[model samples]
Target: MRASRPVELVCPAGSLPALRAAVDEGADAVYLGFRDATNARNFPGLNFDRDEAAEGIAYARERGSRVFVALNTFPQPGGWRRWTETLALAADLGVDAVIAADAGLLRHAARHHPDLILHLSVQGSATNRAALTLYHEQFGIRRAVLPRVLSLTQVERLIDNVPVELEVFGFGSLCVMVEGRCVLSSFITGRSPNSCGVCSPAEAVRWEETPAGRQVRLGGVLTDCYRPGEPAGYPTLCKGRFRVNDITYYAIEEPTSLNVLDILPALVRAGVAAVKVEGRQRSPAYVREVTRVLRAALDACQADPDGYRPDPEWTGALDRLSEGQTHTLGALHRPWQ
Candidate 1:
């Protein structure tokens, strides 16, 4: 049951050091964004400027690793110029591919940089073969990162039917809603991940200490509260513990990491072109350890898929870095659905 081909390992690069860490730890490719609202993870003090991005690209290329620029944010009517400029800069830097979501931006990239590789971001929301085909035919997208909402069987079916390359989320935080389409954040905060490149932006977050517990609020709304010695989660409206029929709990989703270690072999055999690790806002140390562990796991699974089991040490290492110190199979396993 070993993999038929070596699946590419796509890691994240939030900063220059993280980019080096990803390459040093054997990532096949690293995805990053410019320090602007063009990319999805537009947090302060993160991402690379133009010069830093060039350096990162050079470092990765030297190690036989590819670098992808993420211009995944959609542009408003008046802001189309910025998205176009970001695409041009990414193409000029000789990036291996551009992970884009907006239709206009993709069309602009296809027309201006026809030779550059175009990868439809998960934000593009092409969950089925028909949508994938439309993107492939219209904009010449070579690959598409599937949203995490699909099950293992669904992914296999889409891969069997679609002509473009497929990439799936192997490990990372879980977003209950599909990427690019979630409007909950925008409703609560004045910003949206698709347009503003942020979710529960730090500027709008508030933390309060009380005798009862620690209270977390996002844009003046109580998101989560944790008692003494409890692991407090990030303040996101989706992962919040709320009252439902007199019981307070995480009704929508909990704060857990997505680890597909047990299903790596199935994904590889399903003809997945790549496995993406989603965390560009994490620290360099986080990037280093996660890349190292996933690289080992992927290599091990390829070598002996039938005999493969997730190493406890690797799981522990990732768990320490996980949100709420927990992990799940996400939507990959049907029973969880």
Candidate 2:
């Protein structure tokens, strides 16, 4: 059978307002995490409580938008019950799907709630077709969120080999390290990103003034220093400036967002089943703007396959709502230098 027409837009919803904004602006689905360690973006003041999640799900479904609950973090030893219970609750609350990364959690969801759709999280790092297929065989995963490491060509190849739906990140922050493969945060902060659902926890970030300028630090170790009028990026360890061969430069990646508005047609042709906009930490206005623009783009692509070009004006609107001044296609093309 020919591949399904382009893909739907999967937006993020960190709060009830964000969910409403996404649906109002036009999203086919929204993915969110619980206000606990079960989801990866578990920062303070983010995520929804159980009652709020149910309400959010109802709100989306009433508007013809689906909700996917992300129970994507690995369960801590001796704390698997929490993860298991969260999946059960999500099923009970009638989420359209549960995005999972951990094998144990996947097994639990499969056993207890076999009817629920399971989408593999990017944290699973299922980069190749073989790995993705293995998950399909073992856990009955309906979809796999392709990692940020594959190029458009590689994505096409992978899709040809796999027998499941594929979701690709269309817009968001770029992670230099492979998702779930990263241990840098744990090494520094003694907190596991895979288990705790947070990388570079906000409480661990600090800033101070130095004689030369100002210093941005993570867990008391200086990660970046900024002089007057210089732009200071978030002090994520992977994006920190470092010295090598007697010269200092950003060792992993510069602080930048990923804007693939210009490449949406290519991604569609590559057999992407869904285009995901990643920003659960973002504001409702951001969700509204992006969902609206991407919805229009997707509709245009579907309406005229051969004559579709994303609107440059929509891209500019997205750029205005982006996080940082720097933006890149990121590892989708090649490893960041």
Candidate 3:
């Protein structure tokens, strides 16, 4: 056995079937959320109810995999009780950890349920060691998920400084904005992604076929227009093409996914406790295939970090599932900054 423990493989579970697929595919842990605004991915038909969460947790535990409940969204002015009650529900469900972003929610979790393992969500946006220290000292957080904005060098530096465990995103959709602060969707749809749990929510999205091409609009504002043969992506404010200076281009960000298979060894060697896969909004097949590939890559890295190489088959599988059929290191590999 290696002297150090292997980095954990954390997977996403949008439903009970996804939870089972993850555990069966070799995930060390799976993270999910309740079907409410308390979690970030509050889509129309996603997330778990109380009984489903209980069953998922039970299934994971039976297979030696852990379950984390994401109460990761900020509670609105008068909605604080829902946050607290969900934390209570997490404890009652016997989940392994509670991932949260709100200061008050973390404080309550620390004070009221001292034994509960608190994980600072990526939405917490704690980029530096100082912020990690504050949360560790005040809220007793055991792990903190890093926002996707940090470069690989920054992540290594933070790991050397923080007292708590660190988790980083290894795969999934790339958010152009900082994790918890985007208000673009709310500005257009009047539904806050931070508290209401969706960006460019489904109801506000409209698709219509025009003679020029197929166009998609968010809250009646044209987000994107695609040629007849081109692929039409989901309409989101950030990923939309806008006309600026008489030139049409993706002003904010083009649609892409983050894939870190090439750097799995570097992260494993750098003392990261867990590698998280984003997308509780995806399907069970998505959860299964991603978990399968990452599990294989992680196991290989653990066995021999220096000699580890990402398998071609693994790369192909992830590429097929990637958003826009393209991938980037995201901010992990910086140009100059």
Whole-model Cα lDDT per candidate?
A: 0.91, 0.85, 0.89
lDDT of 2 at 336: 46
* Clash-forming residue pairs, model 1: none
Which portions of model 3 miss their true places by more than 4 Å? 1-4
Report the C-alpha lDDT of model 1 over 190-263, residue by residue, as the tens digit: 99899899988999899999887899888899888889888887887889999999999999888998999888
Model 1 stretches with alpha carbons more than 4 Å out: 1-5
Worst 10 residues of 1 by lDDT: 1-10
lDDT of 3: 0.89
How well does model 1 score by local distance difference test? 0.91
Query: Model 1 Cα displacement at 155 (Å)?
Result: 0.6
TM-score of each: 0.97, 0.96, 0.97
Candidate 2 per-residue C-alpha lDDT over 77-101 given as tens digits, one digit per residue, 9 for 90 to 100: 7879888888889999989999999
Model 1 CA lDDT for position 234: 82
* Candidate 3 lowest-lDDT run of ten: 1-10
